[model samples]
Each structure stands twice: as structure tokens, then as C-alpha cells.
Target: MEKERNITSMIAAGLLALAAVVGAPERALAADGAALLAANCLSCHSAQGGSISRVEGQRKTPEGWQMTITRMQEQHGAKVSAEDKRRLIKYLADTRGLAPAETAGWRYLLEHDNNRVETIDGRYRDMCARCHSGARFALQRRSEDEWKLLMHTHIGLNPTLEFHSLARDRQWFPLAVNEVAPALARDFALDARAWKAWQAAPRTALDGSWRIAGFLPGKGAFEGRMRASAAGEDRYELAIEGRYADGALLSGRGVATVYTGYEWRGSVDIDGVALRQVMAADARGERMHGRQHFADSRRMGGALSALREGAAPMVMAVMPAQLRRGETAELTVVGSGLAGAVSLGKGVRVLEVVSRSPDRVVVRARAEGRDGLNDVAVGSARGKGLLAVYGRVARVEVEPANAIARVGGPGDAQMQKVGVAYRAIGWAAGRDGKAGTADDLRLGYLPARWSIEAADEEAEKAHDADFVGHIGADGVFVPGDAGPNPARPKSLGNTGRVNVVATVEAAGATVEGRGKLDVAVPDFVQRALD
Candidate 1:
């Protein structure tokens, strides 16, 4: 029993020692977290109400603390590392879990942390720094709605940010306006009084000359005469001249109302382009802050900040027209900001141009030439055999004539024409040397006259009867008297002469003779011989 009691005491002491060791770390961790919070977060936040008194009772979840730390790094230039961020979040979540009373303040600070501004100028700088300067923002006195619309318009045109990003940024915008606009309004109120004094005191001073030098975000710069007016405080008018990049000379007249401290609101019409803008000087009055709006389809409005500088006069001119061939006509080119010149075509030529104004010119092109043919060759010109005008030509027409021949007896002859239309006669031949065979059978043009002779091939050769003849209108040959009968007659002795054979061919068809002929000698010849 004594041994067992001793063992139990040792076990209890061991358990107590382990508990002390584990408890020591928790205490150390809490102490370490307190130290970190004192070193970093206390500067901007406090347990009691102070600079950021709204968040004094606020508690945050671990995630909320992480998000807050990231916002600080982005907006306020805080440099907390990943490990430190984790530790900081753990400490905040353990020490001050979210409480109902602190919810509104905590949410407001977290949402608006990026927009918090310690100074009026800082607010202006943050709001307009992306596209313009603080000076440009300061020159405008638009209401909150107008400011929101301007920002929305810019966000629409800029594709870099998404809708969600714009929505997030827009939530913080009101906070910025609240911080900076009050200061601007106070400054403008004082400027109005000074402007009134300047206008009342101004007299006997020559107006300053303003000559246009160039343009800025929202307004044009010029150097010419600026005359003070007695109608209102710091009221003035200016006549300025300058040149555009295209060599066109521009002249403008403007009226301005000055607010004290070098701030001015004005509208001007240069050439035909109208512009409105606001300008203000910094506290030191060394530079101007302004916003300009141009009368264009885009209705572009932006900020402008520049130092005062001397101006000079220059001139610019309109560019000539650039013409190019397009299909069957010429293309007339007109640039966005420039006027277009006149052009002419094949049947048209520019006669004259009447100029009513620099921007408005009337051009006249008269038709002077015949309609041009579709196909034109540079060195040589040819046309279709058939008549055609400005259109495609058709195939050539052909009417080939048929072939014809004649056949007849010794003293009389007949003719006939045959075979295919739109065709020519080719070759013709005859046979010889047998009783029933053809001889002296020369083929020729059916002559104006025809006569039959002996069937001797030699005789036909001597007569040279193979000549070409054209088909007559009646489609027949009218054989005249035979050219002096052949010297020898064809003899058949007792059988007497039987018949004369003739053949005709045309294209691919042939016609042959098949009739007989008979001759009777007079008895007077026999009596004369007796």
C-alpha cells in the first residue's frame, strides 16, 4: 500500500507539470500577438476612440483580417508578409471575435478603406489620377450624380476593368467625394469674392493679347486680346488665332467668368468647333487645373493641367482628295475631320468647283464622251463582226451553199442542183475503156451552154471540160448551144448510138444518167451523094 501511494503521487505531479508546460505556450502566444498588434495596427486603429474611432469596437474573423491586411497593402502601402498576415489574422480572431455592436463600423471601414483620404488634395489625386490629374478634378463642381455618371462613362469606354471591378470601385467613390468636395466648395466661395474685387478695380489697362498655341484635355490654348468686362466680377472676352495640323487657320472668340484665385469658367467657338471648360490655379497659383468638353459626336470630356506659357499664331490647310479605281467607278475618299475633293470618271469630267465656304465646296462633273466599251485593249482595238453595244458578242452566223451539176444529150441538155445546204462541192471523177464504161467523161462546172460528144477520154482531155460552175438562182443549169460539135462522133456501126451517160455529185450524194438517145440522118444526104 505504501508503494502504490508513492506511484500515484508521482503520476499526479507528472500530470500537473505537463499541464503547466502546455499552458505556458498559450500565454506566450497571446503575449506575442499583443506585441505585434501594438507595433503595427495601433498606428491606424486603437482600442479606444481615436483616428479610426469607428472601428474601435469592431471584431473580425480570420478571413476578414486577411482581407483587411491585403487592402492595406494595396491602398495604404502596408508591407505585411504572408506568414505575418496569417499570424495577425489568428491573433485578431482569437482576441476579438465579431460582435453585433461592432458590425456596422467594421463593415464600413473594410469597404471604404481604400477610399479613405487624410487630405482634400489626396482625395482629388486618388479619384482622377488614372486619366487626369488632381487639378482637373478640382476645377469641376458637379453634383454627386454627375460625378458618378462621368465615372461610369469612363468605365464603359475603358475595357481594362470588368463590371464587378467597376461596381466595387463605385461603392467607395462616395466616400472620396465627401472627403474632398467640401474643401473645394470653400475655396470656390473665397475665389468668387476676389474675382468681384478684381473686376471692380480693373480700369485703364490695355487688354492682354492671346495667340492660340495648342489644345489640352478639355480646352484650347491661345494668345490674343483679352478684354475685361464690367458686367460681372472678373468677366472677360478673348479673340485668339492658331493653326491646326492640316494647315488650316483657326480663329476663336470666347467669354470667361473668373472666380477669385485664378479659377475661370469659359466657352469658346474656334472656326466651327465649340468647346466649354473650367480652369483653376493651385494654391501657389503657378499652374492651372481644368476640364474640357468638345462638340463632337463622341462628346469627349477629360481633365487638363498645364503651366502658363506664351503662344504663337500658325496656319493649317485642308488635304487634297485621294482617289482610287473601284470596279467600274472611282471612289471618293473623305476623312473624319477633313473635306473631300471632287473626282471624275470615263464619261464624266470635272468642269468647275464653286466654293461657298472652307468646309462646303460644290463640284460639277459634266458628261462629255460616248459610253465606253466593256473590253478595251491598250495597243490594238477589235470588235465583233456583228453589231453590239457595251455587252458580250455572240457566235458568227454561217449559211453554207449546196452543190449542183448538169446532164444532157448530144444536142440538148438539162441541169439540176442537189445535196446538203451550207456545204461546198468537193471532187468529181468518171470511168473509161469498156463497152458499158464511161470515157472522155470530164467533170466541170455546168457551163452556160452544154453539148454531148464522143465518149473518147482523149477528146474530153483536149476540150478540158472539168471546170467549176456556180449554182444559179433557179437551182438549175441552162445549157446553151454546144461550143462547135466534136470533130468525131461516137460510132456504134449497126447498133447506131445508144445513149449518153452523165453524172453529178454534191457534198456526199450523187446523181447518175440512165436515159437513152436516138439520131436519124436525113434521106436528102443519101440522094445528094447518088
Candidate 2:
């Protein structure tokens, strides 16, 4: 409990740091946003666009700008008073906020604990996410040239980056400049019209009482009430009270600072536990949705939602969002005004409706042989909750197509072991005997057998056979030692790329899904808060 408290305190301190800093803005000469930036940033950063500076060409979220400003303050001794810093952050973020359309499909990546596997092309994940959280890249907007420049800076500063196992295995620099940079620019580029329209749009007001519901993994589902009142400009204080599915009472209070006029960042204490909240309000402010994570353990937590008092029936949550295809399971659907027939939508066969109430329902269901997101329905009202269907293992997909395992050495600095999981999904070949089409059924993850082997003769020569770690029966990857071995390539460091295979017998035939592994230096392994 003491340890938990300490973790909570650390989390609160980090999140509340900005709140506290901006709350007591120091007295300074009244100046507009541009003046504040000129005084604080224009010294080293050029105000206008040029070939030499990154600031003019780059666009970022408020959190991204905050990170950059904090780094500038700590590393380069950029001088700015608290007031000046606050103004500077606002100036930069307002001028550089992501266009709403640009953020449409990807906001969850920024505002919540999103576990839905992002289908990033294999090469980019190996090249980028291995070093930093994928959010680091997803949160920024840049031109092709800017993206290329960033890669050049990376290779220039960390020459080791190119020689790492992944880089050496592929044509890293050429692919990055030619394919990756262009892709990122095309996908995440700045749009002046979108930005201008968003700026001109009215912002939502998030004050007053609201009904709330959410899920806490392991602890189970919950329903609650929330009251939000003004704290400052674009900021609000939240008081939350709720009950878990097990009838355990829960409560919390926190102050939220809004960003992009929608993103909500809050530090709160729930039932003596510390947690940080990341949520987004819609344009109407009718609902605010996101997640909360335990302070100490980043991975622990659940989804959260808030609706205006007496709002229309909203399906707030559905537990076990994903169900195995062709397997029967009991699911709990939670929401307000859950009445009449509860539909699991299309692609799901409801065996029986076990029970129904205004706020909760239990039913037996078997998801059909389809792989995709399906919505849950109660009576005539639609829900925020989703039900996904994944069929049995017709094929196995080993995740992290490119994965890195580190030689976790002894003691505190030892790199952590990496785990690779195999997903067994059912896919059916369509009329042309080809796999890409609406007719292809997706069966989600299933039980499978896992193993590792050297991919080729070169891998064998590198002693990848010796370097490869043992995969558990449950498909966890355990690494070997951080070697200075004479058996491996000396200049390339002690690392090897192995092949991970997941096998399962389905439809009377053995099917397999393959993925690659990188056993490399500890430095490249990404840890939380890094």
C-alpha cells in the first residue's frame, strides 16, 4: 500500500506540475502570444521559415509542445518566467494544433491506453517505435523534407542507430528517406484549410453535472456520476463518484487541464489510489471519453466516460469487448436505458438473453466467423461500446512482426525481457483464392504453439541459435545475456534476428504465422516513461 501511494504521488506530481506552474503565473509585462514567444524562444529559434530551423515547419499537440519546451528549459537554458512559458506554450500550440480531420482516426493514440494493435507497416515499427513510444511520432505533423531531416539528425547523432540489428538487416537509410518519410508526410501533413476551420469553430464548454460509466480491468465494470465546474480558462475541476460491478463504492476528484480544446489531462485520487486521466470532449461537450491509468504502473487501468445529466441513453460500456468466433460466452452490457431487446448487432448470434435491466444485461453469445468491429445495441439506441468478433485459428499471426529481445544483464540497469505473442485468427480465401477483400473472415487471437529458430545461414553464423531466447509455452520471449561474445560479430554487437513461428492445427491441417525477432543491445529497448 505504501508503495502504491508513492507511485500515485509521483504520478500526481508529474501531471500536476503544469497545473501548479500555470496556476500561479508570475507578474510580467502584458504582451500578446507572439511577443511572449519572441522574448522567450526567438533567440535561438528562427521565427520565420528557413532551411536551418525546425520550429517553423513542425506542428505538434499541446503535450508535444510542452515536452519540447520542457526539454529546451532543461537542456539549453532557454530563459522564460512561468508566465512567459505559459504564454509561449499557448502560442505555439494554438498556432500548431492538429487539424480535427487529421486527428480524427488517431486521437485515441494520444488520449488513452489504446491496446488495439496498430497495423503499422513492418519496416516503420522496427525503425521508429523500437526507440520511442509510437505516440512520439503519431503526435507530430511534418513535411517530407522535415521528416527526412529528423531521420538524418537521428543517424548523425546516434551513429549506433544505423548499425543496430534492425538497421543493419535492412536498407534502413534509403528506405527511410525514400518510402517512410514520404508516407509520414502524406499521412500526417499539415492542412491550412482544416486548421483555419477548426480555429474558427466554437469550443465546447465542459461544466455541470454528468452521468459516468467505465471499466477497470481485473476489478470489473463500473457506473458513476461526475460534476465538472470551472477552475480556469479551459480548465475544470471534476468530482466523481461511482460503484464497481461488484458493488464496491468508488470516488475521485481532480483538476483537468484541457488541450486542443478537447483533450483532458487530470490527476486524481480514486478510492485511495492515484491515477492520471486522459480523455477528450466532443465538439458539443455532450460527452467526454478516455482512460485512467494507475500512477505507478502505467499499464493498469480502464476506459472512462461522462455524459451530461439526463442525457439520452448511452451504452457506456461492454465488458470483454472481443469474443472468440464460434465460441459461446456470457457478456455483460452496461449503460443507461438498456431496455427492450439487446442486440449484439450483426455477425453475432445471441443464444439467449439471460437477464435485462435498465442499466445492465447479460446474454450468451457466439460471434460469427468474421473478423472486425461490431457495435452493441440496446433497443433503438446505439452505444459507444463495441463488440469485436475473431474466429478460430485458421492461421496464426505472430505479433510484432519485427520484435527486439534484449540480453537482460544483472541488477537494476538490466534490460527487461521481451515477450512475443501469437494470435490465431480465422481467415477464409475468397472466390479468387486470394486474401484481401471484404469476404475474408478475421478470427481473432487463439491458443497456439510457439517456437523460435534461426532464420537463415547468416543468422546461424551469427550464433543466433545461441543468442535466441526461450519462448514460453504461453509465448513469452525471454532473452539471453548481454554478451561481449567472441562467437558473434564484434563490430555489430551481440545481436541476431531470429524467426518466430506460431503453429496451430485447424481444419485438419497445420497452419503457421511467422514473425521476425531482433536480439539486440539493451539501449534500444523502450521502457515506460523513457
Candidate 3:
């Protein structure tokens, strides 16, 4: 069994999907896995059906079960080996996991979209989200009694639950037990038609070859093929090979397991760097979509979408996501099952087909004056808005308008350096011909002149721009080492609050876009799911 590290990746944890070798696989059966669970959890969970009463009433993702077992050991002194734990988690997830539909609206939580500002409803926001991530609870399903039990556990563990700011002003315990519990139960009920359908459906068979179209936000596009073969009962070993938009080789090896039929999770060491792959394979397993992440740096990574080799015609990505009008650039269309002539919509002309393959096609295309997103069509397959062509730059915007960069602790094991990557995006004014409006046409990433400024006088006084970090030519902000600059006031560390600024030269003028960056201390507590 693979080591289950504390991992949660971004929306794009590389791509790992296959022909799921599933037919009521023996490992998925609850009978044997129940025996393993009973060996470890029965000691305490014995209070209820002597083996699996509490667990039988609840359903969750693989990660959720992992956290439950981890917490069991932490708070209840339960003991289980890593191998047994892995088997148990897979068994529970397969037999009693949340259906893929049930996990909707909260996939961002699984993808570790930390920068997301969740718009949870007020009741859930105040009562649940204020204490922890709304997604943490959103991914779970339970009965009212189970939710009540959870509330009891919360209060038992943290006696001050009802005394916090959000709770202190009201009859917290009564409201939680009465209103909140029932609402959660009704909304996130354990009984769901989706779950039943999921179990009854044929599981995705994940073995054989798959072609991938993955995009790393700051890094551009990557196209590759992965071969998966059965390694263990429910686990499959993977071999990935591909290249980036620039033709740099992307290769890796790893293993993946499917949970609840469609949830795909694995880790691949690409070019020696380990990355976690978290994807949602469709019911048929013919397609998969998810994020690939830089393992240790939870904040860094990209998204991935894949198609099983020999499957239906599907266009995965169009390189140079966007282009400028009246200009010709060599474009790459990456996808599978592609055949016939390549088309770049009405405004763009495919001047030449430099190279062609089922998975990739390089074409020299020229954009006419018309400006808008264009569909890249390969015969019958079409990738909607895979490529955008714009006439002129109307505005420049910075991605991830707000971000946090952790101060490097140098040699400290717990405090690693965090870097911030900034990209300046160009936009073409739409039919209204005005920037900053809702109709702006995004013109893809623009080469920018990156800089930083103190957000305020207080920051300026601290020489923030100099001490916090330096924005390099590539627009990457590399922070200084951790703390105690003896030459500075109060011997402070390299921490600051500042604004990230980028300038784009468009139509003989410089348009500026800005974002916020906080250079701060490292996060000490790391959880499996953030």
C-alpha cells in the first residue's frame, strides 16, 4: 500500500484516469473490509451495533474517512496499521461513500481551492463555517441524530463552542441542537437517491491508455498519455509521459485508486517531483477531470482533463488559449480521437498543418479582425472557446487578485518558503467598447512589467518592498528568509503587506493592473484536507 500523506490538491492535480477494472471487486465488498474495521474500530464503535453502527449511518468521501480514522487515533486512542487503514478506507468509500452528485457545489473543498471566498448561506456560515471550513462539513452526510451526535462531540471536545463570538450572543446550544441539526440533516441527509444510483451503476474500469490535457495556471498547457495497469486488488500503477506547451517533457510514475466508482486519487512523481492527482472520472470512466498539485506546496498546481485512448472524439485544450487579431501564431490543438481538417472558427484561418496526430495537431493560424472566443474543432469534436482571439487590449487584469506568500523559515522544518506567481491578463473591450465592464473579452496572459508597492504608509515605514520579497523578471515574488532582521526596527522577520502591480504595453500605451499580496508566516498545522 502507498503511504497516505496529508494531501489535498488544487482543482488540477494532474490527470490520472483509466478503464476502471471494476465488477463488484472483492476489495469493495463491505464484508471483509468490515472485518478490518471491526478489528480497529469495534473496540469503541462497539457501543452501537458492536461493529459498525455509527459508521453505517453516515457516508463520506475517502478523505473524510481518512480524517475520521486519524481523529479516532488522535482523540480515542484507536490503533490500526497503515495498510489496514488504507483497505478500510477504500472499503467504506466504495460501499457507503457520498455519491458524486451529492458532492457537487463543494468540489472546490476537495480540490483545495484555498483562495476561494465561499458564499455559504448565513445560517451555515455563522454556525458552522465560522469555526472551520464550510466545505469540511458540506462533504459529509448524516442523519439528524448523527448531526446531533457530531454537535455533542464538538461541544464535548471544545466546551467553549457555544461561547465563541458567533455563538455567545444567542442561545447557541439550543439553536444548534434544534434548528441547525435538523436543517443539516434535511439538506445533507444520509439517504439519497443519487447514492443508490451510484452503487447500482457499473463502476469505471480504469486500466489501459489515457490521453491528458492538463493546464497549470501560471505554467501553461501540458499534453500527455498515461498507461495504467493493475497493481493490486483495487489499485493501479500508472506511467505518465507528455510535454508542456513549450515541448518540455512531462513524465511520471504513480498509482491511483477509484473510490465510490468515480473518485480518482493518486500520486505521480513527475520529473522526480511528487504530485497528487485528484480527479472525478465520469460514470463510464471514459473521461476524467480534476487538478494536479505540487505535493508539499498545497497552494501551487494546475488543472487536468483527460480522455481514455480510443474513446470518443474530444478536444482537450487549444494551446495559446488566446490570440490577437490580424496576427498569425503557431497553435497546438491537443485532444484525442481527432480526425480530418482542423478549424479555428470563423475569424481564424488555419494557414498550415505543421504536424498532426490523434492527440496533438500543430497549426499556423491567422486571426481575422473579428474578436471573441473561438471553438477549436477537430472534425466532429469541438472544444468550446478553447481559443480566444481579440482585436486590441482594452484592459489588463491580475489573476488571483488577493494572495498570501509564506515567509521562508530558512532551515526550519515547519516553516517553508512560499512563492507567489503573478500573471497579467489582457482583455479586449466587448461590443460596448469599454473596459472594466462585464463584457470584456479575455485575451489570455500578457507579458507584464511586474512591480510592488507598499499598500499604505505603515507598510512603507517598515521598508516592506525591500524586506518582504523581490518580484523577479518572471513576475514571481520570492520572499526573504524568516524573521529577526537585526538591522530593522524591533528585529522583525521578513513580513509585509503590499500591492502587486503589473503593467501591460497595449496599443502604444501601458495599462496597469494590481493585486494584493501578504508576505506572512507559515501555516503550522497541516491537515489532509484543507
Best by lDDT: 3
lDDT of 1 by residue, 218-271 (tens): 222222222334333345675655443333466777776443324445677766
Q: State how far residue 347 of model 3 sits from its true place (Å).
A: 1.5
lDDT of 3 by residue, 1-530 (tens): 11111011110121111112235446335555655665566455533323256887799999899989888877778888888889888988988799889988787667765656688878899999997788889899998999999988889989988878989999888888899999999889899889888888876678889988776644556889999898766688999999987788878899999887788898889888878888898888898888887787756666787788877787878877887777889998988878888999988889999999877889999988688888889997778887888877888887768888888678876678878666788888988888889988887777889999998899999989888988876677778898688867999888899999999876577789999888987665562223
TM-score of each: 0.21, 0.61, 0.89
> Which parts of model 1 have CA positions greater than 4 angstroms off?
1-207, 216-232, 281-291, 295-530
Of 2 and 3, the candidate ranking higher by lDDT: 3
* lDDT for each residue of candidate 2 in 1-530, tens digit (9 for 90 to 100): 64344444443443454354553432121124544554455456543321125766788877778877877887789877887676666657766777656566666566544434465656568888776656678778887888999889888868888788778887888888888898888767755577678777887777788767765544556777777888755578989887776668999898777766676778888888888877777777788888776665443456678777555776766665667667788887877677777788777888898887776688999877556667788885567427766543344566556665666564535355443333444454444455656565454444567788888898977768566567766566667666566655664455677888888765457878888877766645245324
Question: Candidates ranked by lDDT, best first?
Answer: 3, 2, 1
Q: What are the Cα lDDT values of the candidates?
A: 0.35, 0.67, 0.80
Q: What is the lDDT of candidate 3?
A: 0.80
